[model samples]
Target: MVNAHQTFVIVGGGLAGAKAAQALRAEGFTGRVILIGDEPAPPYERPALSKKFLLGKEERESLFVHEPAWYARHEVELHLGQSVTELDRAARTLTLSDGTRVHYDKLLLATGAEPHRLDIPGTGLAGVYHLRRLTHAELLRGVLATLGRENGRLLIAGAGWIGLEVAAAAREYGAEVTVVEAAPSPLHQVLGPELGEVFTDLHREHGVLFHFGARLTEITGQDGMVLAALTDDGDEHPAHAVLSAIGAAPRTALAQSAGLAVLPTQRGGGIRTDAALRTSDPGIWACGDVAAAEHPLYGTHLRVEHWANALHSGPAAARSMLGREVVYDRVPYFFSDQYDLGMEYSGHAPPGSYDQVICRGDVARRTFVAFWLKEGRVLAGMNVNVWDVVEDIQRLIRTGRPVDTAALADPGTDLASLAAPAD
Candidate 1:
């Protein structure tokens, strides 16, 4: 029922690539499948790296997306520790770091993203760390354990989810934590000031020091080890180690090198793809963090770096590659856990996009659902310590219908019913 001469190649080794490979086999693609990764380890989930694994509560073996034997058993040609250096779009071939040339009838780029490295001085110090890869997490885990035992100080350079999550884990280890951020509040760009204050208060209650409205100007060290960090405010915080948690940039160099269209950095830069996840080149497809696909729901190109995006988009792209009608329009979603607080945010409401924020529960008690509305319609929703309502929230947003302000803000009202027209 298929062309035996066809071969599909996936160019990333993260969650997206692994899921794409799995979907290819499940979709009855009998042709050869090759999965290439620069990292030596098999694909693994990244959320735990900043949460339980960093806190030593989760085992490294549990992070993998699939057992090592699954690849062999599924006949997925796994190429570990190899980087795809050149993409010859004309010939449909990829040149690897080891000088190996592989041909493919179709290609999927799930290159994922890389953590932004601090350009400040002292980043090369022995105690400085980043948390994008498994190896980095493994090394940081040991450093945190030692710092916890010694009652050492840890200074973080950002207050995004990764920075705050790492700060929480450090507190669990009894390490002194200080976070320096340029924004007035944590997650200012994403959550706006109102909700960002919630995160700031949560971390502060956990004994974490926050130097808001400041940026890390320099990291001072001695004998190749971190000693202190200097902020733009001329204050120096003593630190035994430093973690740069600024954020991540999508890896689009490969796609760009092959003349694929990419979005500008300001637009959440990634390889630009259509609604079907097909890139400028029809023979090539992209998904996960690297693919900035046009979203029919949002009416724009979006590239989300959350685990959910990678989890769903890979299979979507795989099906699209198999010539099935596909539209990659999943609502953006991500969750974070810090100290005693856990939150799941669905939809996008970056600052200036929404007109008002309304809450349905007790914000002081940290059990609430906050909605971002534009012109009285639900644009996004976030539930803090609240569960079983994501579907309702998403439905409300999808309906694009205005609801009664009082009913939208009432916890007693059924969210499902609110999606309908008012009586």
Candidate 2:
């Protein structure tokens, strides 16, 4: 029995869940489908939340992946503001927080992650904040409005994309933002030293403070609101508010409660899944930040918390659940635009994983492209103010092409002609 009319239930109605429902219908699956989410709004893009959205450049509606009317036309039921409290994998039933049960032949778990909290004191104070959703940005905006042109202070904990982006956004608000990172440089774990130095200089030039190799000791407060935070270096910095952008963990309690085999998170804790994006229980499928899928590019299973990866991962899992043989093989890419400067990277080139770091143009002027080469193959590249070379590098990374870094740095070289032979 093919179960063509069987119900397909997708949990966590973010970009992943929304797209899965759309792709399933587009692929001509005449099955009963429902999308569940804890939020009251339609699934929307999140990358813009910390950058363009927070900067007040884009309206909320423009961030949505698809319009609500499209879903209506397709007849996909969206359960907004509804939380799935329990999942009975054997029975394929999902229990909502309001005591309603949803049954499905195939279950997709796109439940994303939550902001990592600071264990320091004064964490519950009012002035402190973390940016994850559009609501979070609006709340921060409200706080900034009251402190307009005052000696405002924002202490951002963690040096990840969210933290750095928030730092840039906070500075734009004229908030004296100080970023505290335990690591020596921003994006050290992801981009390594040379490229991270570029980010450090860029942010400092934008009037943002950086506290590298520092740890949070305690967050001081008064009147139940935040005031300042003391660091392990025996220094106290006054702050109007504190934000813990430390990172996030996969929201996997429901899956764990339902007896699903969640994967081990080496970088941080997150739910694990097989190559097909299936949990230990075959009836259940997971994707996005929640399910840790084996990364063919990274050579280990990882939970990619990026908008592009989440979008592709969601539909890939959905298609697999529909008994289609499509595998989600994404290039694992993410971008950050801070202060009119654009930075993009693809794939995680291992530490010293490459034999060469070639630069075209000037690094001091911040107008150059850096390439990562392993043996004779181009693994990755970082470009700033150099779109031409970045595009050429992107193509090679995707195709696993070999190239001569020395020739790439030559100003007169036509990179397209020098690209490695296609395998």
Candidate 3:
């Protein structure tokens, strides 16, 4: 039971931390809520940094999770551009970057993740960049504008979500783009080879070039500015700017330093937590990308780095902190928009875990729902350019019943009817 007078401290001012603060107030916890963030600005939606914001379709102020006045109204202490440098778990206290120590009754670590940087040379060049924060996006936007003015090329060193989305935005800005990936196809790890080819075809049709199975050996620079990238095959790709989007590593230094147990590298490196989002410490919890939490449905620990996970997990963690015997069982969900394609995926299935993928609707037309099945059971499903079937798809996965492949692939079949009957 949480006492109304106690203090709750949330570290990390990203989506997860902001939502947790909102959840505490919404759940009637009249406690002192303090949120500490390293970023100079308040919590903001990061997904827009690559899409709408990068393309100049959305304004800067619109990216904030809540207006500055909301914090004052809610009586939540908002600390921006201040980092929690040390965590003294035994004393239930945290040391801030400014040498101020604050105590808390309960703590939630939602440190999120950091973008991975390439180890190759020339990464420090002026025209090289990585996208993970608002500032990075802002800087890249300016760089893209310059590229557009000069009609220069943008070389992206990865074909994952961030890379592809930025590629789309760069192309929209009139900058020629080329994407290089180590995998045989883009998004092969998540969507598998067949569906991955769909994205390849889409980008190719839009005049975006791809170098599959290619390794970026070096980035060539002159006068501290990026000029080109050299691959393992001795192919030199020219570019006015380079963007590294090879993915991110979870920000777990705070949790680890506080003596919290973290998952091993092989198991997905993140702070280890139970289904309730409780860490090894009884009074501490974790959520969002920083937590590698055990999932009841998948019988494995998953650390999802997506917007939906942060939105749902924060509330789940907050409820658990209030002693609500809650289980954070929401199915892992994520969406990506690239070019004319909008895709929503639900459920969790490791690569190669599914035996088959059933497609409903036309793949060539790029309007369809693809279901991954293991022994006739739906492991995961993705709707591409198809809207309003996510709830039905999630229901089918939760039912855990065998599904008919022919009926699943039939466009005439109603998705709502596919859910298995309650036991």
For model 2, how big is the CA root-mean-square deviation? 2.5
Score every model by TM-score.
Answer: 0.98, 0.93, 0.98
Show model 3 residue runs off by greater than 4 Å: 1-4, 420-423
- For candidate 3, give the lDDT: 0.92
Question: For candidate 2, lDDT tens digit of each residue in 161-251?
Answer: 9888888887887878889999899987777676788888988998888899998989888888888999999988889888888888889
When summed lDDT is taken over every stretch of 10 residues in candidate 2, the lowest stretch is 263-272
Instruction: Please provide, for model 1 over 166-249, each residue's C-alpha lDDT reduced to its tens digit, 9 standing for 90 to 100.
Output: 999999988999999999999988899888888888888989999999988888989888999999889999999999999999
Which candidate achieves the best lDDT against the true structure? 1
In model 1, where is the ten-residue run with the lowest total lDDT?
A: 1-10
Q: Report the C-alpha lDDT of model 3 over 1-423, residue by residue, as the tens digit.
A: 334579999999999999999999999999899999999999998999999999889988999989989988998898899999999989999999999898999999999999999999888888889999999999999889888888999999899999999988888888899999999999877888878999898888887899988989999989988889999888999998999999899999988888899998787799999999999999999999999999999888899999999998998999999999989889999999998999999998767899998999999999999999999999999999999999999999999999888999999999889884755
* Residue 194 in candidate 2, Cα distance off native in Å: 1.4
Give Cα-based local distance difference scores for all models: 0.93, 0.81, 0.92
Give the number of colliding residue pairs in candidate 1. Answer: 0
Instruction: Estimate the Cα RMSD of every predicted model relative to the unseen true structure.
Output: 1.4, 2.5, 1.6
